[model samples]
Target: MPNWLLPENIADVLPSEARKIEDLRRLILDNFRLHGYELVMPPMLEYLESLLAGAGQDTEGMTFKLVDQLSGRTLGVRADMTTQVARIDAHLLNRASLTRLCYAGSVLRTLPQGLHATREPFQIGAEIYGHAGLEADAEIQHLALTSLALAGITQVRLDLCHVGILRAIIAEDATAQKDEMALVKLLEAKDTPGLQVMSADYAPITREALLALPNLYGDITVLDRARQVLPALPAIASALDQLQALAEAAGPECVTIDLADLRGYHYESGAIFGAYVPGLPNALVRGGRYDHVGEAFGRSRPATGFSMDLRELARLMPGAQRKLAIRAPWSTEAGLKEKLQECIVALRKAGEIVIQNLPGHENDQDEFNCDRAVVLENGHWVIKNLD
Candidate 1:
């Protein structure tokens, strides 16, 4: 293998894609700022126990762990920034009122989350803490939607689900409680036979309702079907109501309800949703309410937020988001030399990209368009397009 060989599911960001990703990151963080979300950059590494404290087993498996030379303590690279931000809000800031926070950084994953997913994802997201109202949930949903739009993904189909209903049902049913893992897998795979076998001992209504979950995905009518056929458990009823409210308020042209949706089952305690576009095989954005994730930090707070892979997004929108480049010569003529330096600085300050064509480096212009250049015309430095 060559020395440049990268680990599986990891790769470098070449110049063209790097520019797009950087531009999108700026746009998103600015949007977050406009909403009063404070920015925080947690370290790339932390004590494993503290990193995994509130994130649960699933996140623990995704994190990359190593022994620290400084203290002999186990440290883990963050697989997601959400847990770290939650820790900051609860244990560090300890704010009593609603606190909105945002972060953008690279997270190392031990395994890819799905097809075409890289091991290292540029994770960008926002979180709202210290609030538990449906209004807060609604606000998070809108924020996630707006985030997608800002990424040039305006038309998105939204899927709304509530893990609370499934959790509540599991707590009340003995058979589900006994074989929760099997049922969850079956639900995820939408395997009807497997679900029927697992829920065989459940009461007829409970068994039927459990089996109905996989098919309970579509438009608002799915909620109607759930209300009609599924057991009228109060928790189930409430979850359905919240789904309806979110769908109506979100106003996504295509909205769906899946009561069995539990992507982050361990951490999320309420509504969970995903955003999708036409070409992407996966959701462009995913978020929902996670009311108790900060518990390990010794402060339990209500939280809701969403995150997406900016790398994938950049791939989707390939056009470079850069200003026009103007190439300048490294001239040494007495009258033009000092003025060229000043011209380059002024152009850069005005938010323009001015590339200096250094000696014997013709290939430098290959990566950028040298459409315009600075040259000496009539004993003065002037800007002119290349012939």
Candidate 2:
């Protein structure tokens, strides 16, 4: 086969890996449902204009663009599920008040030519549209905690920050522009000195806040420290209050509030955050409010949501050795398929790994390389050990 025929950065999900991912997806969705986020499966493909309506230039760069032959117009694969949900809220939902939505699906994006990136990612997320208050932010934060717990992730540290503070400061003062991006990079790298150089232009108070960010990652006490150092900027103050409330709601042991987690997508308008697990370099989940994005689609409504990088979470999941396999023999041909299916179903019910095979193939033994086998003997079920 020609090399050019290969799809770039995309991958095939094999049965084992796919099953693991599907199980993880179910866990997240179940937790989300318990939190009152009704699932909404958005289209895999949408009109390019509609999908790009609320997405920024950075997001646009990742989209897989193409023309729809049937309609003679351009279309694109969704790079992110949040934007698609925002589109749904604007045109399809059409509700007067808040609507809560959750979704799980595969999203496609283009990777840089040489850099390694997953072009196809599985995302599970929730969106809340129309509410405008810190409570909404707090509620979402709490839900994020619940999601982590449901996924069997107990050692999770939530880094909470407010985009409004950084955006407000940047919009009012251009002097800190370069420094802010630098600070973002510093945090991304976990580099402290780089942050110091970048934040040198800011006021002593602002500079301290920026510098304190990388090390400010911890429990509820971090919020108290931030309150003492930073001035009472309303947006920042409100975000802190909400964070404290969420910490309280999630209990002292399960959640933490970091005042310096200021990195997020350009569309964010309020609180932003991500969930980190032990041993994972990247966040498993990311979310924030982007009220302004709705305005681009003529909705002019406030919106907030989050998405989990299933790939990242999957990477963190404790490596599971494949389940012990069971092989069924279908030699008699007396309703063999049905009998084999029954055995398969029974094994599944008993939580055992199972496979079914034909007569001679039993000796060939490729299906699951089964740990054990069940053969039909004479007129009765006989067992054979594949050890």
Candidate 3:
């Protein structure tokens, strides 16, 4: 067996990549602050039950669980920050007014969401509690898009889906309610024959409505098609209206509707959406409205937000060049030492990285390209380009 080998899909992030992630993290948090979202840092672990409360139930398989040494109760490593933020809002903040929160941290998932995904995702997101209006959802969506744009991902296509539409249909049918998972798989797989067979004993309109879902995809006009083909249940109508209003708010050209795309239906209580670009294999950003995710915490307020894998985002962004390096000679001359110290302070204050040439090591040992050097030209210290 080899030492230093990481488990499958888990690898080290070296300095360059780490710096990019750090820069993007600061930019995102700065953006969040500008929008009135207060920063919150939840611990990486918690009791399993409270950790998986409400909307977090969907993350069960992906979470890593262990026995707590002190409490003896099982503890789980969070795979998502939304549920934790919900706890902070409902149980900790206990505020009646609207609350906006943002977080950035590493979460250990049991496995990647897809073939090329990472088991450890740097989850960065924001949450808004108390405002249930389309306005709050729009604000979150806009903030997410704005963050991606700040990271240089401008060619974005935003797809909108409402879990409420599908939830409404399922709640209307007793048999469907009894076997929701089976039907969800069928729909997700686009198994028309399976959906038809499963929906056979259902009411005629409801059966037809269930079948129409998988085909409800495309531009904003898909909403018009959905309204016409799906059963005119009041809940479905209201859900569609909300989806339309959000799309309009997001700009018609920037939005698309996918009624059958029930990706987060079970976990997401209301609207769910994903941000895409042409070359990326998965969404760069994901968010939605989960109105009662705080229910388990006892406050149960309306909430919405978005998160992005910061590594994925940093990969898509332009790489940053290593900053200036001012190499100083290793000398003990009292005057030379004092001058070198002064030079190091001045250069660093000017935002340049100063690398002192260490004893018995080449200046190149610092690994940064020796872009500049501190030289004593005619007994006074000065900086000159190495090249």
Worst 10 residues of 3 by lDDT: 362-371
Q: Name every residue pair that clashes in candidate 1.
A: none
Position 27, candidate 2: lDDT: 82
Writing each residue's lDDT as its tens digit, candidate 2 over 1-387 gives 787465867767665666668888888888877877888888988888878875544478888889899998999898888877777788788899788899998888787322344678888888888898766776777777777776678898776667665554454456677556665556656677876777677766666666666666677788887777666687778767767776676576756665555556467777777787888666677888889777767787877777876765676666545656777665546676566667667778988876666456644432244778877667555557876
Error of 3 at 208 (Å): 0.5
Model 1 RMSD in angstroms: 1.6
Task: List CA RMSD, all candidates.
Answer: 1.6, 4.4, 1.6
Task: Give the clashing residue pairs of candidate 2, or none.
Answer: none
On a 0 to 100 scale, what is the lDDT of residue 201 in model 1?
A: 85
**What are the per-residue Cα lDDT tens digits for candidate 3 across 3-82?**
98889889898877888899999998999999998999999999999888888898999999999999899999999988
The TM-score measured for candidate 3 stands at 0.96
Q: How close is candidate 1 to the true structure, as a TM-score?
A: 0.95
Which candidate number would show the highest lDDT if scored against the true structure?
3
Error of 3 at 151 (Å): 0.8
